[model samples]
Target chain A: MKLNKTSRNFKILDAFYIAMMILPIIFGIVLQVLTKPVSEGIAITGARVYFTIPMPVQDFPITESQVNSAIVMVVIFFFCLYITHGMSKKIELKRQHLAEMIVEKVDSLVKENMGEYFMGFAPFIIAIMALSAFSSLLTLFGLYPPTSDINIVGGWAVLVFFLITYYKMKCGPINYLKGFAEPVALLAPINFISEFATPVSMAFRHYGNVLSGSVISVLLGSALAGLSSMVLGNLPGFLADVPLFQMGIPAVLSIYFDVFSGCLQAFIFAMLTMMYVGGAFDLETYKQKKARKSAKNKQ
Target chain B: MELAIGIILGCCALGTGIAMIAGVGPGIGEGNAVASACEAIARQPESKSSVTTTMLMGCAIAETTGLYALVIAILLIFVAPGLLVDLLVNTMNGLK
Candidate 1:
């Protein structure tokens, strides 16, 4: 088939759109450094508690700083989603044919095969991809990965839980809540607690891993540089005396610190989030119901 | 010499801290996966198992980059040849 001018133009436009999206991120880094100059260290300096509820029982005091993390996480999620939503909408309007084509393809594969629930899931998937790209890019430049922050993760968990609860309620609150009691009401609280715990754990797991990885990166780099120097000084010969070799030696480790762990942690965080959300909806019940219908048909 | 060594080590630590800034990718990517996956399960309410599997697979793939960084950092710290050379050199110097 002959290549159409329109098709070629559309390709060019797509490239431009991607560049536009990335422009701000790049600019922000430059501006951020020139003006505010935020230090690129993975350290939690302080905490800001969000709310304080009076408790009759004595316990650790609740401070606004405590919930600050949750708030930050929520904000990051909101910010990422907001950007992705805006971009998708703009793309849809600007390149309707391409957008429709993409949507249709996804719908057939996701909604048709996975079920109708996967219909609107594309937006979220795109959003996650964008955020992952942004997070990974930021890590390369030595900035705090917002996703690695507990507050951000907690915020995400909270958002996920709220969405799940909202859907469950919309479907039928009474029936939905009853689902938790399934096979036993005594198990309801356990189920209920698990649902809420999903986000908390999801958020923390990412935060803990990324944060720990960062610390390790710092410790490793330092130890290597130190070792290289001490070795070169004592040897005092061409075999041992080379500063270029010293720094070059550690660059291998740098690749790992900068590339692999950064992306892996992001993927893990996203996977866990997907798994938790999937569990909240439950798959076993549907299978059992389907099996019952099939058995009855056979009889 | 000790002061220089201290400063150099400090700078390396600083460089490491700088390197880790790239970690933001996996965190947000994973979080978005979780949120979207939850939304999918919410609507379909049927293909939960299949959906979960796909999501886990996707997340694992995303995590590959981050894991590379982690491994490199670990090698640098715990199993670096350069570090072993340094340790040996320092010990030999001390004996003299």
Candidate 2:
């Protein structure tokens, strides 16, 4: 069969995309093979396998989540660099238009939530949103997603928490501290707990969602394989080993778990970060704005 | 000790199932939130985007309680049994 030039090009692209998707898993399996097994003395309880880095000084053990996160960071950095490099001033390229739209949207989102003065936060919010979304989605590529690790999400939440505290302190230390006691003094401990709970909840929300999705999908996959084995055990040779049911069912589940839940969790995390930080500044501006509007009305 | 362990596990399994009942709160809360958001949008069609965004944010926050319950349930299923047994063994050994 003779193939057209476009179809030939598409075939090459398809191969490349497939290879890109499979490369990490292949690399991981290769690494697993190459690495020396842990000694029988140390009991490893979890499902995660750690790769030991053979350093000149000492071997460093790193979890799959860390390795995957580093890979994700590098990929994002390079992709962003490549996409944004040598950009024309005019919106000639679709990439340029997309980039511009993203910037504008993020800027507006920050402005709307945090006010015009806090537009500087747009980049941070955008980065968190993108990182969270990409990390969660990385599970689709058979990688341990970064967000599945509590440390990654917790780190971002901690940053947000500090920002919230810094902004509150910037507003006024006395008022910020005093505000905790307000509406009633007895609510101070609850307020304090709630304050700490913000970051904890934010971190757990993303981590739990992604981790649960991963756990469910893995359980489903294994259950399917077990079912297949039980049902097909009597069948001869290769037919017994083939898990036919495992092919398309998990992909359907992944659409909801990996794609929908991942994106939703990412959006929620970013939105919460923005809302909490913005809210700190919004309090002062809101009061000022209200006062100004009331004065204007009276006049 | 084995019987105690079994009872502990059974109770935890039962408790975990009960904890999952918290899922109903978020389900109802989200449904109400969306219903109210839709009503708001219907009343002020121009404010649709803002209302929807707020609704989603509210839903996400409301989901926190259910997520907490889920985390607890997951821990009970995967982690708590082992830890409980370990604790029981340790206590018995210490008593010895």
Candidate 3:
């Protein structure tokens, strides 16, 4: 019957959303009318080097991924700072509620997945999750997503791998080594190599999903541009360069790829990290094994 | 010699196509996983969240093989053809 402030704000957001969808197509048509048709080759190239510093062994080259990642991290830093600034003992403000919500969500996620003993890892997991989700979501702003770079995802996977190995080694060095030869000595080499597969698989899984999404987007965009040019060849310059299809479709695909998959991958990465690291310290199984060993020692 | 280069390029394309056959394993495996997940969720509606989470995780893990094949195909299509062509050209020039 009556409009509230929050509902009014939502109505404004709906208008903005509709404008975003329509403005692009209108702008594309206008741009086509103005500029010459330029059909660029579509290739899925890696991060570009912005500049290089000369070195004797190997020149240090700064890349798109590096600069964008640094920017993303800085943005995240200021965001956290802004949210937590002017703190009070009681949560009196919306920003305080937001800050508490973020921390509480991440805390509950880590506690549920990794158990209370690994509460120390909550901050680390939150850092990984935030950096990953933010980096993947960077693509919507027209930046080269860091997650598409294998090196970025690989570095995170390697760090998680280190944590996994660290937890495994807590059982004892001899026991850890002996784990590689479990069931039969002949399987030791395979078991040893398979352990390393964890990080490699994790890296490739995240990188491939992110990269594939961008690759498909690029391919679709260029294909639409070409198709538009071909079909509208008989028409004047405006119609020929319209890029009609891309304006209609890419917005939808980007929502699925950038928002859905980006968040999904980030959650999956964090979940896998928790599962692998937590599986290492199966307190019930470890306790039972220890008890059995102590009984044997007593006998 | 030109024909040989064409054949090499063609074969690379074929190999890339063949590499995608790796997708079959994961597709079937993930389908079965989702099917079972749906059954589990239907049997116990309250377990839907946990079941969905587990199914998605399994699907993602299962997807790695297909993703590896896709990566190899990309390399074959983009990298191998150019590298092989360039090497052949240089080798022919040296022979000349």
For each of the candidates, the C-alpha root-mean-square deviation to the true structure, in angstroms, is 14.7, 7.3, 7.6
lDDT tens digits by residue: candidate 3, B1-96? 889799989999999999989989999999999999999999999999989989999999999999999889888987899999999999999999
- Give every collision pair in model 2: none
Cα TM-score per model = 0.50, 0.81, 0.83
Rank ordering of all candidates by DockQ, starting from the highest: 3, 2, 1
- Winner on TM-score (1 vs 3): 3
Indicate the TM-score of model 2: 0.81
Docking class of 2: medium
Q: What is residue B31's positional error in candidate 1, in angstroms?
A: 25
**Regions of model 3 farther than 4 Å from truth:** A1-39, A282-299
Clash count of each predicted structure? 40, 0, 0
Q: Tens-digit lDDT track for model 2 on B14-76?
A: 989999999999999999999999899999999998898899899988988998998899888
Best-first order by TM-score: 3, 2, 1
lDDT of 1 by residue, A1-299 (tens): 12342467755755665555555455545644554426663333322332356677854544422332233334345443333332443344334554466556645544443355545665664455445435544655544555555565567668767866765554345668787897798998888887776666555555555656566566666666566667776775685645544466455765675466556555555445444444445445656766888999999
DockQ of each: 0.08, 0.56, 0.76
- Winner on DockQ between 2 and 3 is 3
* lDDT for position A116 in model 1: 58
User: Any runs in candidate 2 off by more than 4 Å, and if so which?
Assistant: A1-61, A229-237, A282-299, B39-47
